[model samples]
Target: MSLLSFRVEQGDISRGCGFRSCCWTISRAVISSGILFRKKNQVKKGCSSVNDDLFVITDAPIHPEEVSAKVESRDAGAVTIFCGTVREWTKGRRTLYLEYQAYESMAVKKLAEIGGQVQDKWPAAKVAITHRVGRLEISDLAVVIAVSSPHRKAAYEANEYVIEQIKKVVPIWKKEHWEDGEQWIGDQLQQVEYPDGKPMKGSGTDD
Candidate 1:
């Protein structure tokens, strides 16, 4: 299976463990479960797992400096950061804004789980992630990830891993607001379900 596919399945189970417990479990699983198992050829190419910390937020702009500070400490010799910003275009469509909704409690819990996995997968100095919710306009800050390690390579790898994992597992829904109309992104990450015995409006049509 692809890396993302494996993560989607295992991540679903890990998210169920609640915030604190999930973190510990993810940490253990990454080390023992071979989630980042590299092939012999990949290992020869010097490939390894990345480690990072995650921060998730809703309806708030993310400050990179704040996340960097949180991930940095005396022991960390290098820090890497990534910031995701809202853009006006997606897939050739003009996006006016984005409306984000999430299962807040579960989202936070899942973020903690990702952080723990980072710690276990590599000798990460520290990791932090933050996500914004509510309506976001073009150029608005949406998400931030920061990682620190004893070397530049580890920091870079961890930063990449955390962002990819969030896209796969975090229980956040995104609605694309366009001039023509609004369409919710109901991908594999966010399944659509309606109330019992009720037919959802626009259920069949692409909104």
Candidate 2:
């Protein structure tokens, strides 16, 4: 169980910080003993779980309706779903399509761990996560996460947790294609911070 460290921006974890905080407290010993534990926790906190009911694909486009169906379970009282769409701007750059890549096996394994963690933390009915790879146009669905629970709050929190954890832990890479050119953003492995307590900027890759 070697922990990976990552630098996270302040607001980056807004949606799922609560879940991250809870998990971090329980895993503090594991985190504290590892080099770059804070940073790794940041990354882990950002990513969605691989194991649960989640799915990651580098294939063609993803169907939201299908994903929604997969997230449905008889025991669930509520299900929260989140989708990431490819946008046209990044850091003020005019972006074109995006090309996503991932170490598939590792990414899925990590996601499953996240699902298990969510279930342990809350009364989860079901959880599903899916990510798209390959080239994607603007407005294309990049990621989708759904969580079912006995109540709305649990579903909401679990849903938020899944996306944040995905951003942190999954070995997925994205190349931002701009009209001028393209650059590949690598995996995040550091946790740099500002002096005034403000949040940090974009994440870095493990390249």
- Model 2: runs farther than 4 Å from truth? 1-53, 188-207
lDDT of 2 at 127: 72
After the best TM-score superposition of candidate 2, give how far the Cα of residue 77 lies from its true spot, in angstroms: 2.1
**Cα-based lDDT at residue 42, candidate 1:** 20
lDDT of 1 by residue, 88-158 (tens): 76556788887776666666777888888989987555787777777888877666676777776677677
Error of 1 at 23 (Å): 25
Q: Which tens-of-lDDT digit does each residue in 1-207 have in candidate 2?
A: 554443221222233111111111112223244442233211121243334345655455655444545555556555555667776765567787877777767777777777788878885556766777777788887776756666766776787678767778767766667899766665422222233432222223232
List the lowest-lDDT window of 10 residues for candidate 2: 17-26
Error of 2 at 7 (Å): 38
Alpha-carbon deviation at 92 in model 2, angstroms: 1.2
- Over the full model, what C-alpha lDDT does candidate 2 score relative to the true structure? 0.56
Error of 2 at 10 (Å): 23
Tell me how many clashing residue pairs each candidate has: 8, 31
